[model samples]
Target: MSPTDLGPGGPATIGAAVAHHAAHIPDHPAIVCEGRTLTYQQLHRGANQAARALAAADARAGSRVAYLGVESEWYYELYVACARTGAVLVPINWRLTPPEIEHILRDSGAELLVASEDHLAALDGIRGDLPQLGAVVSLAGYESWRAGRDPADLPDTTDRQTPVVQLYTSGTTGLPKGVVLAQRSFFAVREALADAGLDWIDWQPDDVSLIGIPGFHVGGIWWASQGLVAGVTNVAMPFFDSSVAVGLIRGRGVTTMCVVPAMLRLILREPGVGKADFDQLRKVVYGGSPIASSLLTEAVEAMGASFAQIYGLTETGNTSICLPPADHQPGSPRLAAAGRPYPGFAAKIIDGDGGPVPPGTVGEVCLRTPARMLEYWGMPDATSATLVDGWIHTGDAGYLDEDGYLYICDRIKDMIIVAGEKIYPTEVENALIQHPAVAETAVVGVPDDRFGEAVHAFVALDPGAQATPRDLATFLKGRIATFKIPVRFTFLERIPRNPSGKILRRELRERFWTDRVRQVN
Candidate 1:
């Protein structure tokens, strides 16, 4: 088959799509991970067996099945199995703290958890708190567990609108909110592109996709799902390693991939990366953070591939806006744009009052798309506050050019995104405040060369309590994820606050963000 001929028109649901591809391209590679490849037929049979295993574990329709592991072929099998069994797949970020992990399990009411061996200890730490959890299956034994079950296909229990994935986004309330996405979120954009006869994001028959991002995040899962729905081979990285990624591209003949700016930087820094043969790489789609113009220029020259930038939140089903390759002109003023909305998607800048602003105006960016999340799982208040009238109120400050290209200038929300992981300042502060030496603390994002942003904290200590950055970091070790801990702690007499007692984070962030074109790195 010709490359573009395999673009779209697959089954709408993920499970059905896998089955369709297995029947048509049984011997074609479906996934490649850690030097092992699973053909479409193998993937299909594996998912069928996994689905039977899930049923044996008592997972039913709408039951949440959590997976706490890195990117692997097993993750996809379990993910597809959940889709077939009508169970919601709740992918837990293994990097999170035990308390945070416990909260997700308890909140999602996950009946079963599939954990990697490395994370079994962490799971045990919070196992007592998750009363709803009925079974724990180790990734090391996944094969044995599935081998005893039937490999026959399960009955279709899901539709286009059935919720299949639940991704958690950090909340300002010092907790995480589950962003529930339906099956349509995976297929809507592709169907739209097919119907419109537009090839905004190209797919191919022989395309090999490298998924370097973690499967726990929306970007990684969305990228992998796109490749699967299009019947392309996907290379899944268990964990991202710069040198390993460069090797995979050349060895696997990767045709297209997606990554964040931070990852792109590391991949470029690999020894002899520039001289490497990347002629097989057709396109590189990057997002989840901003990119510097200089780096973009360097990447273009080195990789010799078309580059596209996507922008959206988990609530918008990962990407509602896309900056196509056509506008990646060297020295073009549109290089800084976040890109226009995808076909069948609409975007607008809205004032605080929810009124639409004129073009070239900066305001909160709102998006309306069929790919939008069904709701923030079980949080009616949050769902209503963010998803209003079929629009997602993305708390990002950006404007549209006269040509309709979106330029993200700042973040209206106080959320700090390190690399691509969302770190809420309130969550960090809540952890730091537990230290006896800490009187008050405020967290903010600082410009980082490697990561797009790093967490920085302004601290006011108790009188004569005595503490250093190291002391605070040590205290926060088990209380929060290492990345969420502050990289720099500025001792302050007091954290500056307004008369109403709200923190003036913008004031503290000024020293780092001053003179930058955008407040966000």
Candidate 2:
């Protein structure tokens, strides 16, 4: 769709952003996947074709469109097309099982399901059960479906407040909640930066970006939007793989990328990883969970790349706080902080009573930002509890330092209250990782007759390494407090993590707490 093609106002939402760039810089590279590169002009026209096909299939304003596929050019095109109409997108996690996928499809009441070949095979048995699902469109048939559609004009059904993407939460504690984000959610940061003229947040037209994270998370789709808004070239990865990422960085002149700590750890473990060139790589942003300082230090020295730490939740739409590259020094106090709030964003620590706490006082982290999500789909009570008076209660326990940098402690529900003492698992896990033999560890509080609740740990050791409960206990004695050390340690082949690299502590706690009525002491 061209600027003249738009009835009146030209390109207001994300779908409009594509048309905006296409009209201004029609030939610039927009997306690169496999061996194909799509220019802005091609992206705009393809999205228009997709919009027509979707509308023909009974999709219109307020329709729910679900996509089950790996990261690809078509996935993004559908996103832009949905913006052309008022359809909301629910990008399903490809790693989910049939039952899980069914739950999301039913919950969202999705009318159209667009999937790749592999996902189609996985859902062959369960697609019949989805009564609300109207038609399933495969990427193989996308071109055929849009062959006769005209790209000159499209339906105008977009508003800044209209929901765009419905991102499901990581669900570490329970079933995933769908976070509904409006068109303003993705572009507020960009709009704010444009007004402030911040050099650190600026994106250059020549800079190449790599989107290696999974599409199910806000980070993946939101990160891709930045490149489009800047009219830069983006290389989309099917998923994050160590060897594949290394090859892309060295082979494609990749400059910027987003990753979680687990991906960084895997990248560090790959054979001959040090020999790989990172000269072209500039900045790497990581979030989704707390990272160990050891891993952070090692990554800094190995890649020689600037690192930025982001802190946010799906409910917030995007990162409210960012620890920029300058604050990621070896022993800087700010290294442990989640960094200050971004421009045009405000963050504060508040008590349980909903009153603000003084700096250095621990409480809940609350944020007010333009990127905040509109609501959790069909979850009115949850939305009411989370969003209060334009402030989002993050549900994570933390404190703002004197300099306003937020230091995340732990999830308030995940914190262990043992004999009136509070213990955060990340603190204990960080100490355990300091041991040479320990590769990964998860700390939880178990029922104990003596102390009411005793710390217990599930550990995964380094390859060919051995360690006993006594070894880790002794190792952690001086590193952390004695009460925080694990009383019992069980070795595991590997720790379970979500696609976004968040540890599922609830799964681990289920087996131990099944017979009991409650989880905590």
Candidate 3:
């Protein structure tokens, strides 16, 4: 089928899409997790039964349901069930505090929560605070609940434009906002993949995809959706473990995998990763943050030409710009760029005034696409501010080349100016990560009397590796401009990160600038 034909034409709801694919590939392995395998037909039946159970509990069309759990096979089934029932699925981040969970539940107006036993304990701490929470269902008990239900009674297809999921953004500035994604957005992304050369990955019905990222994040959800849409097998890992991931890749002959920079660092740190026979591993798609060029170069040399870099936001359906397999070359300009904008997306770098900027001028990257989120749930003001004139202002400072390749500078908020010179944290962080002792690093601007803001580095040492504050300070002095070198250094066991492996710069700034009144721009 052509790329255009993939857009929201076949199925009105996600359940319908699953059913359609299940009929075509009934006996195909749909999901494999923790030694449990579910075929396409079995997966459909399981989801149908789960939908019936939700329906029996009064989860009708338009109801909002929050799912609190780690990534697992049941998460996929529950998501499918919610899609079938036309209920808005909210997958809570497992790492969130009880207060944070309560806030998300209240903000999303989630009437019901389906949580695993472990995650349910967190809710007990703030159950009294969630006024919108009506009922709690234990996923551990789902099998018992489904045992008495008939799968044949599942709800039929509904409107495709209806909200299928409400993915909460990692709110660095304030409260998290739910990005309401519709069925059409998923279909648009599936179509966009085709334009980005989906065949280059050689996806097949027999291929097994290793899903190591959290299901709540857009990256994880996108990988899961890709498997579902293509009728490929998914080898699910509850959470990312480098040794376990390597074993799965080599043992199961997994064809494709998705990860972030931090996870890739861990995988590369594994002793046997490079030596392992990854015969069937054909692609490693990565994004969520800037990867160091040194790491990318080493990965390409070790893993062959299977590394693809994607640049996108949660609001844009997890893929708007992709560096194709052919472009995974050492010292390639495209590696510095976020690659070209995906098909069906029109992207431009615009100044603060929202007008297009010169080719090399850094500006806020704005995108107009059918895959953009419908709106930020319950925050019309924020939604209006972000989505203007049919374009979504990405709040990212970047530039586009003459050939339309996007070069991300940094988050507009995270950009540092020292003595009137602009410094992107990513640039500084990339340089710091290249140090042998630096396992991870985050660069932020701290208060400075002379320069207005001085660069500060938070460094995490590699296992069995050590470095002193002055050691890193002197090391960076030689590699970067004198003005860009960090004035202060803080050593940590590990850098703070969200579930998707993106660094929490806001958290770092909060701790370092607590005494100051103004924190960020």
By lDDT, is 1 or 3 better? 1
Clash list (residue pairs), candidate 1: none
Q: Give the clashing residue pairs of candidate 3, or none.
A: none
Q: Candidate 3: lDDT of 139? A: 81
lDDT winner, 2 or 3: 2
Which candidate leads the pack in lDDT?
A: 1
Candidate 2 per-residue lDDT, tens place, 199-226, comes to 4455666678888667677888888877
Instruction: Write down the RMSD of candidate 3 (Cα, Å).
Output: 10.7
* TM-score, ranked from best to worst: 1, 3, 2
Off by over 4 Å in 1: 1-9
The sequence of per-residue lDDT tens digits that candidate 3 reaches over residues 1-521 is: 32112235455656876787677767878888888888878888988898887777778788888888777788888888888878889998776656567778888888889888987875687787777677788988878876667766365666658888899874434356899988777667565666566643446656779886778887788778777766788888887788988888888888789887667667777885674556777788887766666678877776663887887777886777878888887777777777777677788998878778989898999887787888999889888988888888888888888888888865665766553344668767876888899999998987664345678989999999989888887887545556667888999999999999999988998776687533422
Structure candidate 2, residue pairs in collision: none
TM-score of each: 0.98, 0.78, 0.78
lDDT of predicted model 3? 0.76
By TM-score, the best candidate is: 1
lDDT against the true structure, each candidate: 0.89, 0.79, 0.76
